[model samples]
Target: AAPAAAAAAVHEVTCSAPVNIAVIKYWGKRDTALVLPTNSSLSVTLSQDHLRSTTTVRCVAADEAGDRLWLNGKEESIAASKRLRNVLADARRLRRAAEAADPALPALAELPLRICSVNNFPTAAGLASSASGFACLTYALHTLYSLPLSVSEASRLARVGSGSACRSLFGGFVAWEMGQRDDGADSMAVQVASETHWPDMEALILVVSDARKDTGSTEGMQQTVETSTLLRERIASVVPRRMRQMTAAIHARDFDSFAELTMADSNQFHAVCLDTYPPIFYMNDISRAIIRLVTAYNRLFIKPVAAADAAGDSAPAATSRGYRAAYTYDAGPNAVLYLPREHVTEVLGLVNHFFPPPAAADHAEYFGRAASAFLPAVDPAKVAALAAQIGFAPFPAGSLQRIISTHVGDGPRVLARGHVESVSLLSATGL
Candidate 1:
């Protein structure tokens, strides 16, 4: 009998995608099925340290009945959802083209792929998991198949899974256009500025709240799409203007313009949330308190800077600059603060001060306090004391789980050569 063909060398490809927080948030979708956005949105891609997803896609020759995927070691049921399969199918179609002239294209079409993915940060703690997930998946597949698609084309495909996922396709400043097309072919992401373009910019992700959100973005957007008229005004007027301003801010490296647009867009998105008919609540007391702390800090320093400018006591040109800290939020309670890396330690120290972890004793007491009520219970007399002690405002002790710090980074990269590394293999016994 012919010796069994030497087991084909296992082929593997690894890719990574960074998490992105929207500055001009995409709340409602115009076409849910196509994952089209109601309005254009902008996002800043964080470094690998704060939030990211890495995926390895490998093809192996096997029975052609079905495909499989394993995420973080546990076998995932691809039948439960079509999202992963759709990505895999696209990859296989591209790989099949290479097989036309040669018989050894790794049999990608008949072979099942084993995919393993892991997120370095909290999955759904408002940290933009969908952004990283779809980005990693599409990137891994593209690498495995050697697809000849640009980042924009891949981003358009990623959007079918999640609206904001499209933005994760690039690093630094990115914008997802709400293209006026029926097929969604034109709706995709484009890079406004690469990370290298803004070398000093950094994003500090504050994990103010880690609890699973009550409303998934899908459900929340669907509700907003049907019930909110305010959404109409936002999509038609506010978002368009903000999109233009944000793009300009990124291009010119105007921190003042960037910060203003970022904060305003965030507030407006949350406002749209509150404007929903039944009222979807995303921010809690902790979120509001963080907002207040940031605003107060800006006001305190900004007023002084302005005064210094008027008195000619500071650098005239620099005095015209704005506050360094810019805040934005998504559908969850987490906050992304954009600042210069030179000030990262200082900003983080300030954030940790105002939002201290709740004392074990205070956790029960602060569970459901509203923004106004919670402020008084924190001991006004002790406010200064705590601020002095921590070097920033003191949050309810134990309120925060932990803080994740990251900066702007690249989109996806391929790490494996074809057919040389296998991610999985069936045993001879076929267990």
Candidate 2:
């Protein structure tokens, strides 16, 4: 009884992980269970200051109830969840390895776990919340139990939860190498470069809609792999070449090459989706409008001033002239734009004027409209004068839900260390 009581004492850990945007998307898996991707991919980890998930892990005496989880205050069972089960098993294996190596380090070795995850962004808006969530969970486990594993090792554990989750374990530019092995032992994320490597890079997240995407990425990718022959072409021909090009562009800090590849790959990813037998449409009219607006903005500014007027009288002509920015979208409608820090304000002004956010306090709104005013990028002024002069592109209302502007950031971080009472999602007794 004494030993049980000692072991039952609640131990807690809190960690925060950033969301990652895949520049080279991972669409299909070679082995679904292991999340072994069909091809290698790369992503940029967003700052935890703006887009991230905070998770608290607590362990207590085992009960028949098994593992428990809470995502943004919603209770969920981990017992039947394949992703959670794999993540927990992986963590325990590492803990066991740690225990075997050291005689005095088995504090929370045989206890049930309760995990709580909360995201700063919309969980269902296709913002890579699962990637951040699983990354945070895996990181917290290692921190809590003092497991002897590197960040990459913990990333492999997160990969079991979601393939993209592996990329979140590294800061700034990261690549998930699709290692050629049946066991998937070699498949894991590696840092191409740290966040500081590209300090001038800026990202603006335009929340096109808070509505949940109809087809989740996992289901959509499965359908693509099974039905879309284009996916095979992508895996065999397109992605490999793009992956090489994207990596070199990042290394060289060539924004033009990087931006061009980013946009092209995103378009090709959607193209393959359409190629699917029962087509999956992730982007709607609003998304298409944003795409057009970006291209127009680039042309209007990049081309000589006379060329812009030669095209038509209605271009969004601004004095700031250059194709210094780029845009990319995931499986969802929301768009993430990359640019130099200096250009964020100019571009953001255009985004707010064109695709305005819907009016509502809204449910689970990430940053919501409240986050707009605080954008370090720019003031979301209706830009009444700028719009009238440059010609406002009136997009449909409610198409946009919110906006969050942030730069690339470091990977996962420990916010609170050692017995943090406030951060724990589990109850006082580890219920």
Candidate 3:
């Protein structure tokens, strides 16, 4: 075993965190500076295998130049970012507190930090890039400084950077509690269930466009807060009730309830955006087309099942229930569909049939690397049948940029030194 003092001398750490897509969307903030939310929100953390942000933090010699940050291998000025500064200060405070109790620990809080972060997926494209980025950064800071912050405490530090980032600290189902405290001390995320709680849940991300969204989420939501009357009613009445029901549905693994709530919240979130003064439009025509396609697919796939199959019955009557997939959108045109693992191939096939990529687009390019093998060969006969059933034509090629096939996944994790060596920007850039 290593000596106890050696741990305090560590100067660098690397960590990776997964992106989380909210089923019950979070919009508007009570405190912009604190990144506190007006309503509690729930999200499913996506697999890091498909989408993740990796950050490496190193304590460097004190410099009058101050700390430096590089995002996706590009240098970015961190001095103007108050949120990033707050996260660093809070982590340093925690480290100082730990050293106060243990005199042997080094005084590392005063050292400057060099942070390098990169995302496998597109940044600022409504994929919760900031959430994963900040989560990874905060987690790495705690590791580098050898702080004793619990997951909940670490989540609060992450929240100061991005509200959704707090939820990225936990695996599977997570809920961000909008606390009433004025100082924002109580506003933190709680785990609803672990990643293994509901193993069959899977997600399909339909990337309508990877280009940067026309309107950023923070600016757009603030506009909605100031002008949209529907948002007021939603915050007052709809969210509280839906939060309770959504929690129940997740615990029960009831797909019908979960699907309905997911779609409803997403629809209302976008509607609130539209109601904003001057009207903010996040969903493009392609986004609307995906919504209609998912709705029709869910409706048209109702195959009657014998009651005897569901429950032993003497006179086994028939009952129909069809909810193969549920779709939700953040403040962008991309659609994330949640469904059972058994239904992944079918739902993906339906998407590929209606929204075929260009003939020239590589299979790995259209469907993410992890999902390439799962992409089923298109069947023209089945496509024709589905087209006739739903009365919707196939979209033009290239309407969708890609499909990310992932599932519920664990939270942030410290990366091994060997793994960090391969992807660390510090090593790659020789900085």
Best by lDDT: 3
Best by TM-score: 3
The candidates, ranked best first by TM-score, are 3, 2, 1
Q: TM-score of the candidate numbered 2?
A: 0.86
lDDT of 3 by residue, 31-79 (tens): 9999999899999999999899999887765663478899998998888
lDDT of 1 by residue, 115-189 (tens): 677787667888878789888888777766666789898787778867888899898899999899988888999
Error of 3 at 163 (Å): 0.8
Worst 10 residues of 1 by lDDT: 367-376
TM per candidate comes to 0.82, 0.86, 0.90
Tens-digit lDDT string for candidate 2 (202-275): 88887777778999888889889999988998999788877777787788777766776788888989998999
How many steric overlaps does candidate 2 have? 0
Query: 2 or 3: which has the higher TM-score?
Result: 3
Clashing pairs in 3: none
Model 1, C-alpha of 405: deviation from truth (Å):
1.4
The per-residue C-alpha lDDT of model 3 at residue 208 equals 89
Q: How many clashes (backbone N, Cα, C below 3 Å) per candidate? A: 13, 0, 0
Off by over 4 Å in 1: 1-7, 93-107, 303-319, 358-393, 418-431
CA lDDT, candidate 3, residue 414? 86
